[model samples]
Target: MKEGWTWRLPCALASALLLAACSGGGARDNPDDSVLHQDIASGRAGAEVTFDGTLRADPQPVGTHEHLTVTTPAGDVLEVDHNTSLAPWVPAHAGDHVIVHGELYIDPGPRAGVHCTHAHTSSGCPRPGWVELGGNYYE
Candidate 1:
């Protein structure tokens, strides 16, 4: 009886640890936003990039897109246009940190941002994209 109890205890503890790790409870690695800066400096557009930032505001639905602003660690503010027509809207709020993977676009004018944040890859969106908030990925 004693040997059985000892083995069960270790097994239970190991299972608990594995469950926490799989549940995304541990610290997540910070995303590199510097690539985005490089893209902007090189006048690059329509490039797929991954970065992290803080939400500047709640998501607003416009046409078929869910638009939101994000402030990067380097203080660069960018507009994130997630297409709701292709995927679900991200449930993010102001001040929430999020990881974004999308295609970057810089207009001829002053505005520059990212779009094509969806899971499906099509002609319009060659590379799949997603937004990570609180361990959940919304594409």
Candidate 2:
């Protein structure tokens, strides 16, 4: 009887630890601002380009980054990604103008273009992307 109780105690502690680790934050729990309406790149996934556009929608949480859709003055649409891990995320809404410098990557659809917006603190990562929103700059 004492042996069985000892095993159950360890098992219960392990289960609690596992649940806490697995229940970390995610999009559904920490969703970004709702978009008022819907919706980067000119090339393959590692090409660097600098462009400007007007924010088409509010920021949305994607994977480990914030997703934004922007429209250039030339009427071209660009999908932008700002890594949540890189810098403190500042919320923005539609019609905000921003300038971005980043590596462009091709994705399946839905304007999924650019990424790699993380500063290279170590070697062997793609070049970081920079975003100038309002008057603040983020990399």
Q: Name the candidate that leads on TM-score.
A: 1
Q: lDDT value for candidate 1? A: 0.86
* Predicted candidate 2 versus true structure: per-residue lDDT over 15-132, tens digit per residue: 9888877866221111111121112323345556666778888989988789989776666676777777776574678988877666566566644455665554325345655677
C-alpha TM-score for every candidate: 0.76, 0.61
- Residue pairs with colliding backbones in model 1 are none
- Scored against the true structure, residue 15 in model 2 reaches a CA lDDT of 93
Candidate 2 residue 117 C-alpha distance from true site, Å: 2.1
The 10-residue segment of model 2 with minimum total lDDT is 27-36
